[model samples]
Target: MAGPSYLVNILDSNHVSAPKGSVPSTTLALTYLDLPWFPSAPMQSLFFYEFPHPISHFMQTTLPTLTQSLSLTLQHFFPLAAKLICPPPPLKPFILYSDGDSVPLIVAEFTGADVDHLTANYPRDFKLLHPFVPELPPSTMSSDGILVMPIMAVKVTVFPNTGVCIGMAHNHVAADGSAFMHFMRSWSSVCKSKGDSTFLDEESRRPFYNRDAFGDPDGCNEEALKCYWHWISSWRENLAGPTKEISSVDKVRATFVLTRAQITKLKQWLTTQCKNSSNDSEEVKISTFVVTCSIMWICMIKSQENDIQVSTNGDDDDDDDTFYYLLFAVDCRNRIGFSLPVTYFGNCLAPGIIRAKKSELMGAKGIVTAGKAIAKKVKEMESGALKEAEKGPSNLEEMFRSGHHVAISGSPKFRVYDMDFGWGRPLKIEFIHIDDGGSLSLIESKNESGGMEVSLVLSKNQMDAFTSNLAESLKAF
Candidate 1:
């Protein structure tokens, strides 16, 4: 028997720009925070909603509103429609926007696809979700060899009367999660109000693009450039080659939830453990994010314990000392010791890393161990979020070399489920790019308050192990 398949028909494709004369042509220099991710793959996300309308009705009414509202939103966020201009060595890259620059918007129809299955919490073929997302246009080389790359692309796939999926892909150099969510909310607000943006507050209506807000006291920008140069030089050929697609034949994507009650229970258990520990002099800051991530980290490691051991058979003496790293990004808007607006555009994030030995994470008190490491890292951020910003690239390089690492892709604070594009709140929201790396995505739960929705993509066997471990660990709390 043949495997499952999905059929997508392209109906229309066009570029949507800000209103004429609304945005001025300009160039924005890359910041230190954006330099490291300059050559990384674009971030892709999918938002699923129930339309319950005919295809003709959607194209006649819904599609036009989305495109028009997107255009209006672009007037305030012109950088999203700009192009990344990368020159040769000795020169820097910047975002450039010409008068006619626009973002590609694609409208398509997904036939014979079960929207309900795609949006369900159960495991499903991960590859089925790829077609809905729009890929960034191929980078073009100018006469002088400058690489011109588009910053963003959008796609809307209609499932007849069942539902619709809105997929977006964006270059990280253009903006971070906070800035991206702001744009999303602003666009949804305008569409909900029928193109009237007066209801939005000043902070929501406009983005702060002044790069000077990010103060680099330690000259981290210069150091970051040096690191980026080394990396780009080594990966230049791969960067210039065609995009590589990962095979998802035996891979499955699944959604898991941590209810508010379960989270509270886990936090209480960790607090008690900390109090009972012999080394009680040290303080451990615990939050929903800390506890949630700690448990997930433990589960992930335990699920892959066998594979980890086999990979380290050659060095049994050091198998117990093998290091595993958990990495996440922290927003620096308020922590940078300045009065920068929460709406500051572009990337303003610092890396938060937690390192532990394999034995520590797989021990009987693994959750406590992981929680303490994460809490300590969070507490250190209080002194200075970017105190060690210069070492970010080097630390990441070391983590990859170790081959036991897991990074986070999304934040629950983004509140993606709350985005209502005049239809209603999204039935489901997913960070599609997490499949590219050993990363998991977290978002605010759609049905439960103070809860989190965690999504992961793993091999079928590993997923089964993870699910079992997750259930057993949660039951203990």
Candidate 2:
């Protein structure tokens, strides 16, 4: 197998900021919800769009529009251009923005690259897509030795007459997926309007910056911070390690789709299974999301069964009793008992976790078992989004060591395909960060056919097994 042969030529690199005086100097405190994700990796995404025009045309026209609109968009989303100020120990972390703060944007061109293959649904070399995204600038030390990290960076890579990819890297602590998608749509709207934002409603154009909107009566903020410090004490190397080098492992990324009809079939099958089961009293709230995730969970576990057994040295008793977990985030903007604006920014996500024994999840009733567990966890969230907020960090660490776990990123409701920057909807959107193990990204289908797209990265052998398992499961449905 040949290594990635494409070369990326850096065309320009510069910083962009909001218009002078448009955004006042600000300091935003990190909420308890944000602190846990402070040490995690930055969220990286690549949005590909077809651009069947010459490079000269792109430079002469598209480049200026993108850069200018981004600057204008920052006037409204100024926090994205802010720097995260991490003071040592007892001092809490906060985002700071003053005069002259700006986001780093890089322009590049990929030579000898196939846009079609990169945008295809089939497996492709994971490393080949890395260069399209810009790396966040290295964290700097303040005069007092505090860590100062940029929150976001942007890169635009042109495939020269084939397509263009707008890549972004943003600190997850700065914003959750909901907030990030809001910024994306806002930026695209501005670019599409050729730098006019008046077309958007005031509520849509600006984010509510009041951190006080999120009430934390339980002192979860302080507790969450304690958890962060405790976790970081053991990972001192990762305190400023979001810029860690990309993995060198041989991996391939592939996209799979579950159409509306297929998802319905899975739901029907689950209903029938529940009706026939001895434990029919158990309530499983079946939905498109539940069924899709349930089927994926069953297939993923079956696909990796051999590897799990080998890692456990074929300890049948222990292996059967071992637990596998799935974690996903739920947007809490509306769920929390507060009148927070839907546009209120920062992280308002509650962790949704499901744990199932290996034997249960791999059984013939795996989908039913997984669905019941997931639906229960989600139902628990309805009582209070942050019901057990303080234990999140410790719980997350335990799941990581459990050896069999998966984290779901993005969401079908994001409507990522609706983001049109005058060039049209994105041909494909890839969540670059999911290449890290035990993660998958989901988004709405590009064709507006009410289907959902799931993307993940795996080794060749694992991908083959996953494909086979998915086919078999769907056939059963």
Candidate 3:
């Protein structure tokens, strides 16, 4: 059975352009590091803002104010308003930001829903919230067969007397999470100042567009292209039939909160266990991210193992031999040895992977072992691993082809909580595009407390098993 069906009325839809004469027409080249994520899923985020006043107050006052401020902010972020013009291969794609470039902004009204239930700290059927998310233009294959992508889209849904939610769909290649946060913060600044153009600081108002500052001494560009093409070729060959969309009926999304006390205890446990287990030169530094991610990673693996155990009637020796990999994106802003501008706009992230066996992860020292493996990868970043990032995730692709793997979607360092658009700080931030199996999202807790909120996506059965395993594992801490 389903809950009450909410009604969504589209009140307005129009393109909001950058202020006239404010931004110049320009083209920003897409780097090799950015091109691999070209066809990847668009990063989606939903921000809920609650107001004590009536919904009419938001529609009459706050709505227009936000629109004008957004326009002003877009004047500085012109690339986001432009079209991603991709040429047929061997030629790289570039953003064509001409004068009068605008982005689509949608305003809608919702009825027959409880904003409290929608914004609660637990997971509900995603369909209940799906209507609030506006659909972006899909990527198109042109007559000449080149893929054209949309850079960004926005939607604002107002829930009558309760609150409003802002939905954003952004292409991953245009900007990493840091750049995305920069744009939102700038918009919030303008709105807070009552549409003042100068409210943003000089650093926040400007985005550095130079690609050569990355110092790619080796020709990593061609290597990246080769890897990307190989992936596309393989995908086409393997998935030639009609693709089936995943049924939301069998899936569930949920957020797990890690309190400061829990995090401290987890770190202490990992540190003690790590010291006893390894004699490697690299001492395991158990940071909050390392410890927390290690526990979740181990729990997820255990849940999968339990599923396997049941399916095989407890006779599958092959389960012990399964290889698992943890892949995460490392932001290279501070890792490249030299300093790039704090506001560098394009993608400057490198993919990193850590390998482990399922049996090891489900073992007694699993959390410590996983933490050490992640620590080793972080060390590579400190040692100038960005130099090799343009080659793409070489080992990750092979592992994805062979067996089991889990990937982290976002990092905890992104200041997502600072985005205040005058109404208030966001009540929650959710990554809506995390559908692939074993995918998890990490974001700073919304309470501004020094803790983490991990969002997991899994089948109903897997989620039930994961929560149980997570509870048992935390008992030691």
lDDT values of the candidates?
A: 0.83, 0.83, 0.76
**Residue 299 local lDDT, model 2:** 76
Tens digit of per-residue lDDT, candidate 2, span 1-477: 355587888888999999888878999988888888866788999999989998899889998999899999898899899998877677888999997799998988888868888898998887778888788888876677477789999999998878899999999989999999999999999999999977444765578878876667578877877866664455545445554455666678999998888887888888777667736466767777788788887777776775556666876455678899999888877665655677878988877878999889988788888988887788777766667454576687788899789888999888899999999999999999998757888888887576889999887767878899999888987
Segments of candidate 3 deviating more than 4 angstroms: 1-4, 139-147, 199-201, 227-244, 315-319, 387-391
The TM-score obtained by model 1 is: 0.95
RMSD of each: 2.3, 2.1, 3.0
**Model 1 agreement with the true structure over 210-323: per-residue lDDT tens digits:** 888666657877876775666545655553422437864478889999999999998989988876863858878778889889998888887667444556774545477899
The 10 consecutive residues of candidate 3 with the worst lDDT sum are 235-244
Worst 10 residues of 1 by lDDT: 235-244
Off by over 4 Å in 1: 1-3, 199-205, 231-244, 278-280, 307-318
Clashing pairs in 3: none
Q: What is the TM-score of each candidate against the true structure?
A: 0.95, 0.95, 0.92
Give the Cα-based TM-score of candidate 3 against the true structure. 0.92
Model 1, position 48, has a per-residue lDDT of: 96
